[model samples]
Target chain A: MKGGLFTSGYGPILIVVVALAVLPFGFSANTTLNFLGFVLIVTLAAQGWNLLAGYGGQFSFGHAAFFGMGAYGIALAQVRFGLNPWLALPLAIALGALTGTILGYLSFRARLRGSYFALVTLAFAEVFRILANASTFTGGAAGVLIPLRIDAANFQFADKRSFYWLALSFVAFVLLLTHWIARSRFGAYLVAVRENEDAARALGVDALAVKLKAITLSGGITAAAGCLYAQKFLYIDANLAFGPWISVEALLAPIIGGIGTVFGPLAGAVLLLGLGEITKTFFTWLLGGAVPGIDLVVFGVLLILCVAFAPRGVLGVLRRILPAFRGGRA
Target chain B: MGVRARAILSHGSMMLKFDIFLSALANGLLTGAVYALIALGLTLIYGVLHIINFAHGATLTLAMFAVFVAHQAFGLDPYIAVFILTPLFFVLGYALQRAVITPASHGDDGNILLVTLGISIIIENALLAIFRSDTRSIDVPYGFSVMEVGPLFLSTPKVIAFVATLAVAGLLWLLLARSDTGKAIRAVAKEKTGAALCGIDVAHIYAVTFGIGTACLAIAACLLMPTFLVNPRVGNAFVLVAFTIVVLGGMGSIGGALAGGLIIGVVESLSGLYFGESLGQIGIFLIFLVVLLFRPTGLFGAKA
Candidate 1:
């Protein structure tokens, strides 16, 4: 059963990965590559959000806290401690997991859930943002800048394609991990807890333990995306790292794609970013200038429309329209 | 200097410090009055609808912008604008809940959260698109006037805000306690299915509650215009603190919110005095976290 579980999803997973991997070859334009890389990084963060929210039913409004920790972790390690970028990446990811563990422990220990939990997470993010902004350890408000050196050894690639490939590989790894979790017993336990915590606890499941593990895993994956962001941008600031925008994007992707599905984040990320591009371009043309906030306004409308029309997401819409397209949930 | 002289100097300084503390407390109370007003709307909506209106801040921002536009374009006094904007905003809020949020959310908690969030994003950005990102504040005639009482000087606008807030709260309390609509809202809040079974229009009540809450913001904006600056993101500062106040005051308790806002305001002021302005913001979040963790019901709230 274990072997079959592991093997069954690999075919579709491999096909998706291979298709994404070869996309740079078809459209090697820097703009296209950059867009894809950004989308893939966002997909990683969304996947992290999906793990806890979609599967575990623990909705965090502050995934940015973990994402920012990863970003600051990488930046501080490289710039402040003089650690190698490659070593910094793993440490950064670990730092995010630790943050998640600490926050999850405190919040869950108090039995806070639902909107209370969501608000608390948001408060935590705000606290972190304020601290990071005020402390000299984070270079105050001026922010930290990693000295750029274009080299494969330093994890800084010369070509956009290399960075795109790196991002794709990380996303692919997380996708597989998600696929595994979807099939594993652990996943079943998580779903059970999400469906009804009291019932699951009655059936001998340690709901707290399952939640803690889910948050920890979620944090680490999101931090990896943050780590990648720092590597890509070579800069870090309090707002950029711990902002509500990243948190919004993280949740928006999984929600728009299809919550609880492995590829939902990926599909949602692609569609969201594509929609963003379309809105920006269209709005710019309509307004006769580049204006801020229009894309986000459109996103807000889309979010409401999605909730109203397609509560299950784009995947759900597709399933409804194409009844025979049921290939066993993405 | 002699020992007696030195001791006298120290005593004088201690007296001065006490005076400073008193003033800070007074200032906190005045600022908190406005905060309570902002949070009143939030608590009302939450009590009835059970959804955290993420767009609360944006609506506040929009109202502030309305006040600004009315003043800039029509040369209207903010005090006068309040009467006009409040009713207008009530209608806006009603339509928003009835036409947009209620229909969009479909009564799911998660969907409601997303829809509100989406509404916030749209409203905030729409303001940004129209007003640009620059902070704007009106120069009212009484902007810098001060009221002095027992070694404390309070800004005239803030003092007025405090008095007006109390009046609004009293009015709201009366409305909730006396009116049939208020009884329906209270009934709906306590038991939605029961209220529905009793032939009360739950949707209309929900929209009415939302409208009342948003109307509170219009009043808050008018009161705040003379003293506070309005930017695209300015409402965020109040929104977070308002949430903290709502939780601290007890989720649905009107009196608790008022008291909580005042307490949080004083705490913020004292923290800012010692910890510097930027770091002082942490005090609010800390209180928020603590209240949420330890006393989710708040002081005046009935146990869930």
Candidate 2:
């Protein structure tokens, strides 16, 4: 285990943690901290999605269902039961895991795979969004306020710096956990199944169990991000929690970074989220207000270009570049 | 509780029930025809290419805008614009498949999916930029006309839409069954290599197949103009329904698409009436899930 901890993935994660710790001091801008927090939250979600879709090959288009479930779960628990946000956070995670397990079991047991799996997930997301919109408990289309402002006891942070630290910690924890899982026995079994399910099954891997476990874990982690998002934003809406745009963003990150790798989400989060912020600022600067729908158009075009040209992603490009440095050393 | 009295009362309630049932069925059939026209293009492309064309909705929207422009600028009827637009769309579709889609189709499903998704995004945003997001409908002078028979009422536009659907579907069926080019297309769908060996131009068949699929949307767009408020995002609603229909019909089965469309339409209409409007979409998804669970091959799909 110690030997495994010394791998390249862990080294970068440690560097990331150190950088995050110093970031607040170096950048006093509250807006910058806010942006960083948003990126970390997105990174967590993307990593969670990569576990299942990238590693397990399940390709879910309904991950937003889990995200929304987590957000609404926390909101409902806090508003109705008078529970603390921290207490409700666990419940939110459990809700996501439960829903993910049920969905995975149903779809996998029925032998749904590939495009069918994606369609089923998408259908569920649509259903959940529609339900969220109609339910008065969800505050209907107007959405629900968090009911409490930032109080440490309430699991809300009043300061952007505090939110950034909280988000950074979560990102670090998830990254470490994901790295550990990728090297564990179960992780090996998952990769085996991904490469060739039939062969993995013949070699005594319970393919269904492995996939279900990955899905459950992925869903739980993604929902945790949702919980954080609700606390940070102090509001929850069906569109924010269950939007198809969230799913697209989640899928795009890992694909652009280096799918099925530990640092993929981190790399992707940096590039995509950075570009996104820059684009927003640029558009606002140039057009007076952000050009409506231009970000999506650009993002969509980027996704196509990435798929066409860089199938292996930026990390893959880095891998190719690293050899040149080693050759120079030699 | 006398037999004659009970029998008479039973007959009276049965007649009343029958009337309600028939009216509901008629309403469902009319809507189903519109759904079938939209779904036909989707299933046709899926059948021939094995790629789920995510841009089908966007393409339909583009055609809708074309009709709207023709109506506003040239004083042509929306229906008349179909004749001009359908063939034009066919050529566009053919070119797209040949130049873009076919190269990406070498069993790499992900590339094709992303490409179509990109196309959808591009078209939708471009339309939004050009036309804005305001709702536009071509309201014919006779759009509000209706036919009444006994106790039932039928909208004239709906009836025409249904007839147009049937005529287009029948024409497609005839083409596939009787025409040599259509036969070649079907052969290519069945076995690409075998068709090529038999001297069929496989690439041309693929292009033509996509052409026919896009042409089907022209009819659907014109039919939908009177009923629906056309806008940049109008396609989003139909995309999901069409996907559900295609999956329920059995992938790559034209007859199955027709049957599945009717089933979904009826189910949606009845659920909307009995339950609520929001529940109608939920009902459609539930049916999709159940079908996937119990009959993975779908109602008319061939065994993999």
Candidate 3:
């Protein structure tokens, strides 16, 4: 089992590393790095979502709140307390976990299950967006720009290569963490809880506690991605951080990839971001200009099609293709 | 003499406060009537289907656009265009329900939600593609006309909207209470298998129920066109508010929907007046959270 898992996982991880190393050299410095950074951050977020919705069986429509909180946590710490970005990173993760815990506790305490849980999560995110938009602390609707000049100590990389490396490291870390968790006892509990909450509870699983644990962990990781996103972009705002689109993208990636699988988010982010870039470039080439909202429309359509036909996702498809690669199959 | 004069002034001041309260109450009622109209279809669909039609706002927008096109192409008044558009929308609703929605609603609530969300995206984007995201509004001849009752002034468009709301609500109530078809719909809403066992055409009624729900949007759109600008994204705001209202009123309760819409409207108006404009939606959301925390089944909802 271990050998099979390592072989299947190594294929994609090796491919990603090789591609990352070769592509930056071939492509434009700014464009390739920017895309890579986006993919990394989104992959991290999608993984978090997969843990909650896909594995834990508690669909949260408001995971963006964690991301936004993470971004704001770092931004606030850096701005107010003169903290280094590296120092602020852990703080953001903690805050993200706290937010997730509060949300999970409140909703779970009320016994809000299934779709109600999803909607409440969505409402919480929306409420956060509204608060972010209204508050002076978050810089309101216009958002905040980090004053840090790019440097190694500040965690702000001066060159695109440095940013790419940092982002890649983050993505790799999240991927490994996800793999570890999936194999752990906690993971089995999550699967049991998802499969049948009542049965799991009957068997002394403490379903709520398991779900809250998954959500807390998921939220923390997602928030870490937000910190990375803020660092990469050098700016943060309510719209960018807490927007419904972020939540939608996070959910879509996992669903499009195989939701319950460890490497599903990575597969999803690559497919989605790749297709999105291709479509964007093609449209730009055709029009000699950009069309606003076309990408969104396409993404929405793709999501619908995927949900309608392939609920199991791209990784699910890959699993079928590589039947010999069934080691880590969820 | 001075004490008597002061007492008279105090009594007069109390009358003024009473007058102000009365006016606010009247305005709240009017606003509530409009909310009822917007939320009625949402409640009906939720009641019968047990699915939240996230695309209800998009359907409303489409119906509004249809009316706009009719008004532009044929030079027809919006009130008159409603007659033509309502049936067209009904048919469209029926086809949509039968073809797209029913297959998706099979035991999986998530699938139903996704499918509707997909339809919403498609409809919204289609509108964006065709209309180019430009805001459109009807320049009605009597849009600004108003009637005065003592010190209170009521806009003609708003009054007409209110009247239309009552008319539509009454018709729906009659259909549900008096008509055989309405009874069948109620039967379906109550119990699908039992309705089928009772020799009711469940599928046909489901399609018709959807059609009726969409037709409610037709009336709502016509009523709103003169007063508000129509845009591709406008549906989103309305959809959120409608959802809040539906949840507040309890899922699948038409009367509850009516009351819930009124409560939301009044809350919105008061919030806007007291807390300023930007905070209005925030206020509503706060109320929604409070309600969800305390009474998830809603105030008027039947016990689950």
Candidate 4:
């Protein structure tokens, strides 16, 4: 509660934030915009997860459920019912919260903690994946394809810059909210619960309510990321929407970048996804032909190495390299 | 399914429903045996280490692929393959516990989970790179045959899986309940500090337990080769089953695993009739969530 509004001491982060906002203007190149969009959209989901796992102390293995819901919420709204994608965005996010509320309530009330709690979420996501695959409305295995109309209301744009801006704005909003949560009184209660639920409850923390609230907020943010993903790809499939890989990425970003850090998720996303692309291209060229997911193997090795060597993440490493870059607690 | 059936249908219909139930029960028992073996391996590791081996399913997947390769190269039958790979997987599991899991285990619960998750990612993606994601299966001689016993039908491979599952579980139970090393392992699982105080080699027990767990997977993998297709993503499929069984059976309980596996197997088989294939998996996961929330210690778990 004693921390400032920004984790980067406000000044450096301010410049970074400003640069990110105006980035598309100067560097509207497709590659830059594409990469930014991916990172920013993924950042939304990763930050949500970071808030929950890093701060709230709930290690969820099922964030893909909310991500899938967000993707389906917007996809089904616009394609199945002809609703505007813009209008559907909030609906998607709300649905994410609703799903989170239900699962969170059940799990918290039943006293599911640690890996069991995580497994429950994973099971829910798996269930959703199968339901999506079996249903006729989701287009079954082939997936739902949005009309290629270049309309603002549809959230489709001819230039990738608009997509980048939309993603940046969403990520910025979530980051600020997370910033507030991290410094607020409620945020303290969250950390307390994460550190020791029984003791937190002994001090009258209302453990169930605190956990549920964190999960709901996290779910809503992740769902919005899902919607962004759907809009960017213009395709929604069972696998793409509810795949375990999405959940893995959501957790991996924060863990690798710096779990519980405000900028960790963003940093992790950039490092993992960004490095993933570079290594993939480099390895593919070296080996000749598509190496077929060697980059993922690299990622796995990297994750293990990071966990073993730098449990605190990249921000932790940065802090070690330059002691001046330290303040917030993880 | 309802008493209304008595009023609206003939005795023949009632008998037919009974027959269907019996058939499902038989099939469930057979399938549940295999599920028990797989889930038991997961539970054993968790019991001793207090860490969720997210990569357990991936290791099982690795064993399945090993069977596939053994078949392709040497034409080794899955039955014989199980015996051959058991020692090999035991060594692999032992080395992994020593090198990767041991360090991460001391870090934190999340670290261990994430580390295993990383291992899974590496194993799965490596398989994808090498195998190209095509589904592979073992063609056993009696792979598809079914035996009928008083209106109950059982698949041949499934029966073999059931028999082999029981044998392995029994052998493991004996080792844990009777042997000195098994007592050492149980003591470590129950109280790591106390076990160490008693001069037990806790780290060595951890490795041995992990080894036995992976050895169990080797057996289950070969048993499943004739029934299920092997793919890089097969871990995703079976991990859910193992999670459900482990939760329902109570982690670290051998008999409970068999019982829980049977229950889930029956539920899945019966539900498959109504929900079809993929939805059947959804049903299993739903049960998993329910058990996880309502009874996190599982039915047989008594706060151990």
Q: What lDDT score belongs to each candidate, Candidate 1 first?
A: 0.90, 0.81, 0.81, 0.87
| lDDT (10s digit) by residue, model 1, range B84-196 | 99999999999999999988888889788889889998999988887889988998899988876755667889999999999999999999999999899999999999999
Listed in order, the DockQ scores are: 0.77, 0.43, 0.41, 0.66
Per-residue lDDT tens digits for candidate 4, residues A28-92, read: 78988898899998899999899899999899988999999999999999889999998999999
Measured by DockQ, the strongest candidate is 1
lDDT of 3 at A97: 94
Displacement of residue B53 (Cα, Å) in model 3 is 1.7
Judge the docking of candidate 1 as incorrect, acceptable, medium or high: medium
Docking class of 4: medium
Stretches of model 3 off by over 4 angstroms after superposition: A2-23, A26-28, A284-289, A322-330, B1-24, B72-74, B104-106
Worst 10 residues of 1 chain A by lDDT: A1-10
On DockQ, who's better, 1 or 4? 1
Q: Could you tell me how far off, in angstroms, the CA of residue B280 lies in candidate 1 after the best superposition?
A: 1.4
Worst 10 residues of 2 chain A by lDDT: A321-330
Off by over 4 Å in 4: A1-8, A327-330, B1-21, B146-153
Q: Which interface RMSD values do the candidates have, in the order shown?
A: 1.0, 2.1, 2.2, 1.3
List of clashing residue pairs for candidate 4: none
Best-first order by TM-score: 1, 4, 2, 3
Q: Which stretches of candidate 1 lie over 4 Å from their true place?
A: A1-7, A328-330, B1-14
